[model samples]
Target chain A: MSDIVEIHMPKLGESVAEGTISEWLKAVGDSVDFDESLFVVETDKIATEFPSPEAGVLLEILVPAGETVPIGATLARIGPAGAATGASPAAAKPADAAAAKAAAMAAEVAEPATAAAPATASAAPAAHKGGELLSPLVRRLAAEHHLDLAQIAGSGANGRIMREDVEAAIRKQLQPAVSKVAIPPVAPVSASSSPASPPAAKGDKVVPLSRIRLVTAQRMVESKRIAPHVWTSVEVDYENIAKVRARHKDRFKAETGASLTYLPFVMRAVADALHAFPAVNSSVDIEAKTLIMHSEVHLAVAVDLDEKGLMAPVIRNADMFNVRGLAKAVQAVSAAAKKGTLTPDQLQGSTFTLTSPGPLGSFASAPIINQPNVAIMATDGVARKPTVVGDAIAIHHLGVLGLCYDHRAFDGVTTARFLDHVRTSLQERDWEAEIG
Target chain B: MPTNKEQVAEEVTYLDAISQALAAEMERDESVFLMGEDVGQFGGAFKISKGFMERFGARRVVDTPIAENGFTGMAAGAAICGLRPVVEFQFADFISQAFDPIINVMARHHYRTGVPVPVTLRCPFGGRLRAGPTHSQSIESYFAHVPGLKIVAPATVEDAAGLLISSIRDNNPVLFLESKYLYRRLKVPAPLSLEPTPLGVAKVAREGTDVTLVSYSVGVQQGLEAAEVLAREGISVEVIDCRTLVPLDIDTIVKSVKKTSRAVVLHEAARRLGYGAEIASEIGEACFWFLDAPVTRIAALNTPIPTSPPLEDAVLPQTEEVIETLRKVARS
Candidate 1:
């Protein structure tokens, strides 16, 4: 007899159900050695290569690369040890061999059972034959309940049975009937134990808060309790800025290969204003009783990631980058944050922040200050409307800026001046000169 | 003080039961408080919180500004600071204004930070009284779409009181949608204890094998009434109250559908993108092979609820619609 070797895919992990074959190092008809790299599989979390278990000629490859097979499934077959011609009988056409093995087992069982019975009893009627030992009704009921014939152990003549056997089997498995009993209802708990006291009796349900919203709630509360927030709103005439944006947008995109947005313009204005009023760029130290002025401005731009939530990704050193560079950074950071692929470093280090509810046409929003930052600015929805331009009312691009600052750190006057600076910078933008 | 006999046997509306849950939770747990427009001295627009202010005082039972966004945000803050805030939206329709706080920040807080927001937003939704488009609205589907936010709609007074307590003690943001129509209608024997009803569990209000009527809020009552009416006609319909929409009790739904092989989802919200659609889809996916008929949804028409009584009646789903849908599902 030849030893039959069963080849199977190695179990990768406890939870891994399947793995994709990334590469196959061995080819058919190639001589292989033990522990040789056979193929690599890639799972969602990690990738690893499987090694050959035994030394032999590569007889067959059951699975191919880029295919995912279940654990214990045949992956490849290797010739058994000490086999002639380097090919074991076990490696021969698996399908035919399996069929031959099944046929032999069936014959072996039949040979013994038939020899013990009378060879010729004139072939008992088909209904009373060994194969038909189970009555039609019994067979039908057994099939309906998915019961095995052998498990039932028939008790009729020559171990044959009728409908009574099937019914008995079912009755044995089913519950015995019993008379119903009535029980009095219990009294409810006193009103004191009830959460909805006084009016609510019992059988009330209570649900809890979600994690993300809970954190947001906590942060907002802490910010409000710790930071003395004072709001300053101002309208900005963006007539010149809008004109410059429209004129240079195509050129800017073509030159830099980055989409130009109103955010870049607003960011540049805010950066310049921060330089002009350094106090707005500073934060109040609640513990040290002093204001900490940062040398660099790490601007945190809050992006609406979804309908319900906002995420702020910082663009380090906003003062150092021009409008085009700011746009690129914002686009990259915002994209990364939205996909939840941002690294730890990407979300950290911010001295100031900006939030916008654009296109939705929110006129103004009082952004909660990112703690330790004395101020945060918000850009409102921009729309074209009639505005006083010099001596005449004309349709010019206009928008409102809502500035919220910690009153303890920066006074309303300082906040107002910062807004004016941003307004002046946007309204008086000489795009050609600024870009150069 | 003499014990008033009326106090012992007095009947209260389901809305009052909800308020009582809030009041009791607030008194028992120091962290519990009430926050929303008119929830204080005004005692809630629906008067659910009526007399709460005199009992709990202004500090705990506080009224808020018209700023839905602002007050909701503040309530989120209070919840995070260890206070359990039960926010009452004057009308479920007004909840859209605070959608940001409910969906974005509060729903995400627990998943992002591992800290729970024990905040419950109470919305009096649904319509039968000609409240028109503004006052009567069912936006439960909007919040149910969001993860990490538990959506609970109690059809019976027992659930109304029990769900409120569960929401307070729960460690996540919960959208408690109270049906305004059922607030004074459905009544049940008071539960034996104040224990919370488990979330994600469905109750088979009435059982039969001909057809399954799946619903929550006022729809559950409608389903029950429909089932009763159908029973007299020899079509046995099972009514299931899906108290929670998010962590849907899919097992119960699947088992019921497997036994009955037919199902109808009933809700007061518009048919398009409504919670009923979600239920129908889930049922089809889970019990497809077992289903004898395609899941049918009986919901309000896809239109803004009109002011006229005739228009409103035409737009909103009724017991007849549920019964018809059940019959069709059963036959198919």
Candidate 2:
């Protein structure tokens, strides 16, 4: 029989009973193929795309994106293509409360990281006789028992005659003679099932962690546990650098085909500061309790990754870079990283690092220190804010530089002094002359 | 206590182990003797009593005529006189000829005449080798229904030897079923325990949490194979070998059922009024609330044995049947 299947919001995590629709890959009227992604849903732990269990036309969109619904709540309906719509409202009713309850309970007990299938096929009773697909074993058994395949009611996938179907038939034929002792059939356990039921997790897809992500995770966890992290932030007046960028940005972009940003200027100042205070570019031998100061200031620049994370690739001998040189190096390294063209040699031997949330408009961010590097700084949003200059209020370009340092190599006062120098160097730069 | 299977040495096949136990027991007690057809020089039908003719005298390992009734009668009388007689039936299906002596005489000797007849009837049963019709019949259900007769069907070499020692030592009459398939099919280390492993005890052949699988004799081997297949596919199966058939270790079966919340029983005998029905009924009554699914049974069709290989396979219960039944119960 032709029946409409309801696609429900999947419970992506063990404790999560609801998920907000992030986006619908297919519109309500689109015809979906079996196992094709219908929509993307975001749970507390991850964002997952659910596929259509059966190939059919999407008839309705019940819960729009940005709306959170309880697990097992119908988000869409898929029916046979070209079938008349709104013909069977009664068929869409919640017929199996026990099954729906069981699905919800199963989702509640599901593990948080497991990709359990969120949407499920309807629990409507299957009509087993007419078009059941009999397996070879089932067919052999039926022939042996002289049973007409048309007489058996199958409960397998798509109303197929699984071994259970034949066995159930055989059991029915043998029941009266075999069971003279009045044996009670096992009570149908229609109660809420455990979270491990495979059908309940069909909507949950488990994408294995990529190689980069896996290595990044392991290194991040090791760095967090090994280092004693101390964070300090300083408000920087960026009026001068902002003026420099505005004056020369068009000419710079025309010459280099790349945007001129404040990070390149910040990097130039950090390299000089590292040269002044060599301890800030040193690595601590935690086992020997000695600081191994680096001679070359190999500065690592953070590149924004695909939404979830990032990678910091080092620029070799970065201390020698002037403002223009640093800006060009940043453009090339970041572009190479984004294009997946970064070589292994280019990403190694960094003595200091910089990460910026400036473009994304973050007020402040404590960037994690890359291992073997004593300090890392984050450049916060550059916005025009009112500040006191010469005892009068003036609207000047303003920002904050957050420095996260390893306290094992440098104390609070030394880290503060480095930040003060970086602020002074940026605020007192000759804008037009530096660009020229 | 010595543990670990690696510690045990000198492996023996299931049939040889049975012979080992019989010879060991006969050596221990002078009164314990054996009587069966061709048990002397011919070494019985399957050679289970092979070297017994040389080790023990002909008088002890006496060869009898084809007359099952006459020979079984003499054995029963010998037991009544406190001789502790052990009778060997070439095939269990032939036990129908000696049923009068079994049910009427040896089975209820203590209740009828107040005389404890310690008799052990070694019956070789089950089918797998194209030994059709009469020779391959599994008639444990027929004798299991009779009171005063304790039935033991051993699946492993250890059980074949250990359970037999316990059966011989018991004061009541015992039906010792040796799986014809497990005779030379399975090899295990010679039993270490001088003491019997105890009668009326079921063994957990393989431990799991998903579903409880119950079977006896070679069916236990089939259940284990099915358990392995299910395990690989991520379904955990608990296999319980009902070593003793009549006075079944129902407690162990119930405990596994309570833990797994699902159960399936299998037997080579026909499903119509077979012993598995009774076992399933008992499990339902004992652990009804704990069950997540119904107790299922996989057994042979109600038709008689077919001499054809493929036909016999289709009729008999095997690993496929066990796996199919278990997968359904486990899914629930």
Off by over 4 Å in 1: A1-436, B1-9, B189-193
DockQ of each: 0.01, 0.01
lDDT (Cα, tens digit) per residue for candidate 2, span B1-332:
11222224476778877887887799889999999888888888988877678778898999998989998888889999989889999998888899898889998889988999899999998888899878888888898889999999998888888999999999999999988888888986554444586998899999999789998889888888998999999999999998998788899999998787778888999776688988999998998756655577777766566677765775676576577668766752
lDDT of 1: 0.74
User: Model 2's A-chain: what TM-score?
Assistant: 0.54
lDDT of 2: 0.79
Candidate 1 residue A424 C-alpha distance from true site, Å: 99
Candidate 2 residue B122 Cα shift, in angstroms, is: 0.6
